[model samples]
Target: MTLKELLSPVKALKTLSFATESLILTWKEIASLFGLNQDIYTNPLHKPLAKPVTAILIGAGHRGNIYADYAFIRPDEVKMVGIADPNAVRNGRFARKHDLPAENRFYNWEDVFKREKFADAVIIATPDNLHFEPCIKALEMGYDVLLEKPAAPTEEQCRIILETAKRTGRIVSVCHVLRYSPYFRQLKQILEAKTIGEIISVQHLEPIEYVHMTHSYVRGNWRNSKTTSPIILAKSCHDTDILRWLINEPAQHVQCFGGLSWFKAANAPEGSTERCIDGCAVEGECPFSALQIYYRDKKRLYVFDLPDDTRKWNKIILRNLKKTNYGKCVYRMDNDQPDHLTVNMQFDKNITASFSMEAFTSYEGRCTRIMGTKGDIVGNMETYTVTDFKTGRETSWSLKTDYHGGGDHRLMQDWVQAVGHQNAQILSSTIDVSVESHLMAFAAEKSRLNKTIEPVILGV
Candidate 1:
């Protein structure tokens, strides 16, 4: 068996923080389900079972580097064939680090797809605004795709991408990595089976944490709601997607109330300026050094082992902060995108959801509660538990996922395996379920802007 298939229940179960008995039961269940207990074997896949699927990573920024690691998980099923980015420096550095062939690396995505049109699939890890064009083109090129989340920024784009997938007979899967988490999948299965009995309401709070808010919104590319559409699309797309997935219904209406409540120039602690190091007395006290921290961070990922030149790092980091719709000063990086926002959504079948994104928290894992006719379920992502309503018990099943960048690897693996199936419905046929989640975000934004409850729409 492959290392993944043969993973001991004890080992996998250990990642979660469930009560001892619950942990053991979960492990036993997984083992029994796969019959791993009966068919105990060693190194069934000393070699990878699937041949490497050649792929071109369309975005060479942060996420582009991540998808490259799929080759590490199942090297036989994937290979890094190329990278595409508009910036020559980022493109070159990413190509060198991931060992993408020099000839395969292209500065523009269209150049690769138009002139060569190579690879079994393309991974569109590009920025939110750029997703639709490449996705439509990738499908047209007859290549299956792994498109990153907030699939597209607008409802129109979402519809277009989904429509093309339907027309072209190609695969398009979004990076809803949380769905593949063994922890969540188990919880969801139990909930759907009515271990939670007719889930009626879902309460979800995404503790974006001040640090994460700063990383993606303040200092990174996602700070601008105008550019990326609030913390909802930029960061909480996963959380929103999780809510939609948990309930398994179309959210018919949405109303949210919140704003850039923290991290603003007006709220800047007494005497703090626009810059972190320049004329700021608190630079020494702050852990999130705007200059030194992100300075090293920017290059370490994008330029590691490639160049001695520090200029590119400076340029990217400075550009990101200057354009920060989130904030500029380290003490005031809480710009826009609502420090705390609450959403109320009603599903078509009368199911209800309450979703919140908060900037201030103990910086822990996500907390989820699903209430149904039969029972209520609650779990912390860090603790990994799902309380049983029937017995008033919560079991431990803390999930194991890439803590740093989310679970892109497993998501990619599932997408590949699904696509490999000959009669795959979603792998190469449909993408509406994923696309609709993004449309919900767009509707949420419209609600936020227009100050009215917006009706959600999903296209087939």
Candidate 2:
């Protein structure tokens, strides 16, 4: 087939299961036929897109804004042409930042599609529950999608998204951004080369720092499991996807055990009030006090839509605390998310993996250890060391971390190229592969709730 025909979605999906080596070879051979340099097709940066790939932002929140920032950083690679957000403050800020025309600024996500396909892709960074609708709608409307993680709140919805992407032949790139990070990419390379011998077992940890747990899971948008999703899927699906990617195999079974260990009403300190701003006796002492986290320290103040006036910062925060969930006592909130959880998974070929998500840590970074027959590897997010069993020699590497270990912007780079070129193979985290991690997460949650070993089933 010609290069153009081979890059089509229907043809690309047929080779989705091909190893990266085989895929690259095929791409190289095909490029030679067209008198194209191999690197031009394989490395997106080597060949620029004919024009910047334009996108419409569906949810101009934290992630949406983060991804859209790439447009400003590299205007020649990608551009933001439209935005849709219900919150006036957020929508207006995003519209102004992107210099979007009045007609392109939408109050509802549905309105963006009401007119016509205006952009090459649509970024769905809406809430966990809002993912499926926008993603399906965008794909059906002939716009590629950059979907935020957790794919959806449930397995059925995730499967539907996967099926729709396959049938519609649209590229649905899930934000498993870590796969694009230098740290994890190097780790995967080591595993792929058998530098550690045959894979035996893996251990991974995600330290969801104490303050972050309180802000996001206990008092913020994802506070309730039903309203959002289980902590495993909401916070640690990235870990699951990383494990699956490193193993290069699907998980066959999963079992986990954990629950609300603390941060419940029963754990409330003596003399604590329902809200931290209510002069609770423990406000000064409590680490989870909204006053301490938001007002005094200004840690997660980004979640609040405070006015631009510098002098009003203190007043705005105080007023926000009094009315919003951010001001509530962590111990008294209706949060059911587990503060700590552990998971054991069995992958194909007798490979085993264990994962832990801890919310009580003072630090936030992934810690990982991989053991094989001939060697082992261990590392924190910044640096990793590998030991050869035969040579008794150790090799270590260190990398700098940016947003999501520098995966955020890198992902945006690859995604824009993929959409601009109409090639899904450029992405490592397309829905077909990414949905496996979601399936693993669902099975883990089921095992946690049912107190039984659960098989990792992929379809609805």
Per-residue lDDT of candidate 2, residues 191-273 (tens digit): 77677889999999999999999999999888899999999999989999999999988899999999988999888999999
RMSD of each: 6.8, 9.9
The best candidate by lDDT is: 2
lDDT of 1 by residue, 283-311 (tens): 55655556545554442233222346755
Model 2, which residues run further than 4 Å from truth?
Answer: 1-46, 307-309, 400-405
Model 1 has an lDDT value of 0.68
TM-score of model number 2: 0.88
Best by TM-score: 2
lDDT of 1 at 172: 86
* Pairs with steric clashes in candidate 2: none
Flag regions of model 1 displaced more than 4 Å. Answer: 1-26, 29-51, 87-90, 97-99, 284-335, 384-394, 399-406, 422-430
What's model 1's TM-score?
0.79
